[model samples]
Target: MTDERSSTSPDEQRSDPHDSSDGETADADATSDENDVNENDADGNDNADEFTIADFHDASQQEGRPVLTAAAVSRALELSHEEANERLEALADRGALERLAVSTDPVVWYPTELEDLTDRERVVVFPKQREIVVDRPDQFTRAQLSQFAHLADANGEQGYRYVVRPADIWGTPHDSFEDLARTMRQALGQRSDALEEWVHSQWDRAHQFRLTTHEEGYTVLEAQSPEIMGNVARQKLDEEHVHAPISETEDWVREGSEAAIKRILYEAGYPVQDHRELESGEELPIELEVRLRDYQQTWVDRFAEAGEGVFVGPPGSGKTVAAMGAMAHVDGETLVLVPSRDLAQQWADAILEYTSLEAHQIGQYHGGRKEVRPVTIATYQIAGMDRHRSLFDDREWGLVIFDECQHVPSDVYRRSTHLQSKHRLGLSASPIREDDRQTEIFTLVGPPIGTDWEALFEAGFVAEPELEIRYVPWGDDEQANAYGSADGREKYRIAAENRGKIDEVRYLLSAHPDAKAIVFVDYLDQGRELSEALEVPFLSGETPHHERRRLLEEFRRNERDLLLISRVGDEGIDLPTADLAIVASGLGGSRRQGTQRAGRTMRPAGGALVYVLATRGTREEDFARKQLQHLGRKGMTIREQAVERGED
Candidate 1:
């Protein structure tokens, strides 16, 4: 009978989509006449001649057999195999029939009564009240499938019948179910109606809404209901009504509200999924070399316990090393954000030197190269750039370390907080901002987790700092008059640029001829003047990034004893080798800036010295005192030293 037809004939044989029960092929042809007689008798009419695909489906269901091969139906109906095959395929396309794979080359058609098909005949099953069944459950390992079944059984009683919470799944002591059901669904190659219902339920109850960024660099909330929209707009000010310029259906959040929206969602017990693809980072290749100091260890413990917060420590107190230790403890994909390219390089070097990460694993995402790896070191400027924003948009960082976190309150840099991270650590010598935006830091990064500098100095983790306030007389009479007359910004600049401060710089350099020192000035001109007069390298904002790196390397290598720096040196730049720091000028009355400069020389050495060259009996003295307040609170004594050049 098989050889009576051509090989290309539809009934001649092909692989069945449904795995046929054993010996069903021989029975299929034998039952053809019986099926036709039964169908005619059941209908009580002569409609066997006009039977359609729908009629075939109804007959199969009524006969309690949901699956059929095209050849069986063709023989039963006395029609050509080609016509029957085409009709069956059309029914399958219309959802009245389902096609299942039986072998590599053949498929069989089934009526959509999935539940009626026995375990032997069906490959997959979605039971309404019973556990899911799969005939070929070989997609996952037996152990994996067993674990999934266990979780399903446990959580099924907890009202999460179809959906699995990641935390609940991962929190249990089991092998990693990294992608949860998403992975399982992909492997199964089928979707359950129950799973779709669960997804819809989750979406309806989700407290966290996505603040997605459009191509124009704007962000908007994907609000589903009026209540959610109202909740989002509750804190918006009167002038900031929700706008929907993109579409009438969707409401747009104001620019820079992304962080606020995230905070809101987090507080409401809804963790927003940023829909970013995260790289599964590899394990560390090497172990750490230096053991953290006792205080540093305590701070790390606290940071790990809190999961997110700012770590405030004195300069030269090993904040960078502590941060690296935290990363090693977490041992995940880390993104370290810095204010400058120099600091980014410094972080990269620290990661390589201290952690198990190799040179290839550490990528610098700044001016020259933007390669992202297991450990990415990026600058705030680069992170805030619109073109570079995509690098952070869809990526998930396991640990995010913000060096000099005080800079994050600014509008340009605050956008860096939008990058999703599991754990956040903010490292800063002083998190105080001039604009009273320290609250914003607390909001973005958690509250300040601080270690006392006095305790660190007592423990010998950091050098004891000796503060010397040197009185330099104002040499420029015209500038002196301008300093007295000018208000606000001009007055501060005039006082900071006093030419007599250069004499103090010369004296400090002369005093510390062999010691490695950093001369910090507020203005670029002051730094240049001192650098040339003292015959040393000058680093400022205008200095090329490569040259700055070279100069820093030279200082580190002890090829240069004295180097001049500007405002750029106030933050996370590590100059551990420098034993002396001469503050030539500074921003008027910034305690944070002063503490950071003093910290520049506080690395554990024999001792550290900081000389504040200020014009006595002017606004400079008050500003200088304000800067000293940070150290004063730490119990470091400041001594007044009058610079009497000829007398000395």
Candidate 2:
């Protein structure tokens, strides 16, 4: 099993009378942290005559606590409680460490010293590991990091961890290495030689190959050096994919093998830059009905500059509107691909509502409808069909949009990318998968082109949802025994379907009776049980499309404040604005699923809340934390609470 634990930040922990309030304090009174708490301390304590900032950092990370109370500091530093507080307060007085006082403990302390870090005090760079730890980074720093680094996790407080992956280096939206390097310096406030060298090498690797159109109107793949063109491209591809070598550094790519070539080279770690002079199709003028947000305009401008990109933002961050802005910029025939018919219809209505496109100008192609117009919305399944593919393949689409584009790597959705659209655009809040195929999403669609979620949240452009994981005790011994006797996924299933969650769900609904809420479940039986208990409608895949639409419409119109939905509500269903989201189960799903469920409530003006119900001390607890870690990484505070066997 994956080790992605649902571990919370130290301060978010609930005080338990049985456990030490300050982490092992009961056993650590006489024990020296030099040997017990920290591994790096053995070498460091002897090297320094006095305690250094690195010691504090090491102690905090080793103890898995961001903010420590006086007892922890006293134990780790081997000082008296009063002395530790005096020293910590002295540092705090000098603006080295910051402290927050809570009712449950003496003032908790931040390890870093702000006075020494300058304006970049919040950013900590570990060049050797290619990891960045930022503490309470500002919008500017977060924005700079988004340009070249991937947010790996957040401590659900002030701390964020970012990792610079190969895909991030390959898909950096900068025009040149100098610009990217400059951005790194700006974000970090200092140049890191090791990190910069690695980044430059990866940046250089991305430019080693380029795809350009020949004067004869066919595609040619060129390499930076003849050795790469032969040793890499030619060595990997056969005659079926590449026709012949145009030269030592160039290859004549066979027809209908462009996507294959791109995918192949991408897998080989050299992202081919597309510079081909492709078609713009027939001009179809369009205008946006609403004014674009500053960030949305930036997304459009970046796409227009890059010619292809995926809009990666939180759900309510207006990606659809930004896409319409892109359509207005492209001003040509567009093909929008969706995961479901409901999304197709939502896209049509959104296009009409947010843009100047008339009803006749837009059409939908799916199982129920087959209409093609300047702006055609089609399901990915229908477009991937052999018989129906021709309609899309024959069209000279100027722009192709993949909504919910996380499915692009799947076998069915992968085929839809075969359509020869000049400008490929993809839209997804989480462009991630449970498997390793996530990189192909970038290769096939485009590099991610959107601001950081925290930036949007900070600017009040999108409401940052408050996420909480509530651990409920089993309702009875029978269920607990069933969970204990079960094995593997069966155990997870038992925990997920715990009868206690039903009570928790009812409690949450009663607490927020006026708030529009969605209760999500994985299994039909669990959903039915919750539906019956709460007297709410259960909307699952088994529900007819028309009925589903009507229920969603009623929810959107504020006629219904509650609905129990299955996995079908996870994505692509245009779920209406909700102030509350409760995951009754399904924590075993992908991290993206948690984000999508929470995103249903992330509107601009309202206070968004998400509660995940995990059976206490069961496997569901870990799954709950791991799945929602994505949201935490995006700068949302996640709190945890343990419940009694009975209702409060």
Candidate RMSDs in order: 28.8, 12.1
- Where model 1 places Cα greater than 4 Å from the true spot, the runs are 1-286, 476-488, 587-589, 644-648
Give lDDT tens digits, candidate 1, residues 1-648. Answer: 011111111111122222333444345344444445554564686543444444564445444466777766776666588877887887777776788778743777776756543322222324344244333232122222332332132111121122244222321222233333433443233335574354334434442354455656555555555665455544432225345534432456665454575555544534333322222244544456666655566678866665666777777666777787678777777788988777878777766666666888888898878889878888889888899876675556678888889988899988888643357789887777878777567557655666545445654556667888887777668878878889987777778888888777776677766667888888887787777787777888788877887888887666666778888777646554467788888847588888878877665444568899878677788788776765665546677776654432
Candidate that scores best on TM-score: 2
lDDT of 1 at 290: 65
Model 2, 1-648: lDDT tens per residue? 111122211111122122222443432332323223343443357643344455556556556676778788788767889877777776677666888889998578885543433333366789989999987776656777888998877663557899999889987878999889867876775567899999999998899898888999988889999988888998889998888888999999887787788889889988888888767788999987776766777799989887888998998888888898889999999999998999999999888877888999999999999999989999988888889966676678889999999999899889877653388899998887999688888778887888888877777667787889999999778989998889998999889999888888888877876677888999988888888888878999999999999999887666777878999988868887577889999989898898888888776654778999999999899999888876777778899999987655
Cα lDDT for residue 331, candidate 2: 91
> What is the lDDT, from 0 to 100, of the residue 144 in candidate 2?
73
The per-model lDDT (C-alpha) reads 0.62, 0.80
Candidate 1 weakest lDDT stretch, 10 residues: 1-10
The top-ranked prediction according to lDDT is: 2
Alpha-carbon TM-score of each model against the true structure: 0.57, 0.81
